[model samples]
Target: MTRFYWRKYRSLGVVTTLAILYLIVRAKNYEHKAFVFLANVHPSEPWEFVADFSNMKYLNPTIIDFNLLDESGDYVHWKYSLEYSEKLSHWPHSYNTAVAHFNIKASPKKDSYFIHSTHKTCLLFGLYCLNSVSEFKFSHGNSSKGASCEEHIQYQCPTVLSSFCRREVVYQRKAIMNNLFKKFDGRKF
Candidate 1:
């Protein structure tokens, strides 16, 4: 009876191992692009929110701590709060903070303001293999609150080894839009 149980358990273990191996082997790099619209936000609002790393909390709620590591003209390097390692028990142990770099541009185009951002790589958070770019355009409009605007955001991620974190991107996008459209859209920053 003990031998029979042992065999059953061994087979189960082997199957689980095979499944993990299959996932690892089948993991292919991919690229994803998506767009979203934010209503009631001014044309210049999103650009101002992202111009400084100090304002990251306006977009990503999970970030508890943010520190600027380096900065230069059109480039920024920072370590933002992350919990990927804690949540992924199988992931290799490393630093808890995720380091990210971005190249940003803010442009004025007559009736709209465009903010272009490209993410190079993020280390120690399973994002080192991915490259991302985002463009935000805010169009000015008329509203009862004096001046209102719509935000159009385009997001693209390339060379993703796994789709596990794709949903996180979507969530972040929605969070940013939600924050941007909140009651306080005219506050001075």
Candidate 2:
């Protein structure tokens, strides 16, 4: 009877281990989002704005500080500090600051320019982390009246926090675009 009980417990442990591994693998899968928008300006105008790393703080308000670490040819390495807060049920409100690193490359095509960027941020000593790849395509508008931009982003994070991360990504991207338009329309760009 003791041997039988031991075998049963071993089987249960194996199953539990497998379940945890599956959850970790599933949670690490990347999620993707794509969007397009039109702006009343030339493609080069928006391309210039995005290619300049110094303009990032103006484009994203959450970015409290930005620094360009290095630049070589078409590639740029930069880092920034992002400030955010979270309020969870039955928990104290928390304000946090995260530092993220970025590697970006700009490629110019015949009629469009592409900005490809990879972002990495880890929290709690790498216990929780987020990584993302973003591609931005800038070209002439379909109606020939202005410019059009296509943005594709893929990100991975823990399963429990995926929804919150996804919402924040979408919100930030939209805010950046709106700010971009406002800048150009106000003739501040």
Q: Which candidate gets the maximum TM-score versus the true structure?
A: 2
List the candidate 1 regions with Cα displacement exceeding 4 Å. 1-41, 73-97, 108-110, 120-128, 141-163, 183-189
Quote each prediction's TM-score: 0.51, 0.67
Give me candidate 1's TM-score against the actual structure.
Answer: 0.51
Per-residue CA lDDT of candidate 1, range 1-189, in tens? 999999999999999999886665443334444333444555455555665556666555655565565666632222232222112222334323444554444343444555555454344555443345555554444442322333333333332334444665556665665665563445322
Q: Score candidate 1 by lDDT.
A: 0.48
Clashing pairs in 2: none
Mark the 10 consecutive residues where model 2 has the least summed lDDT.
83-92
Give the Å error, residue 109, model 1.
4.3
lDDT of 2 by residue, 35-71 (tens): 4455467776777787675676677655545545545
Candidate 1, residue 20: how far the Cα is off, in Å:
8.1
User: Model 1, 71: alpha-carbon shift in Å?
Assistant: 3.0
Model 1, position 180: C-alpha lDDT score: 58
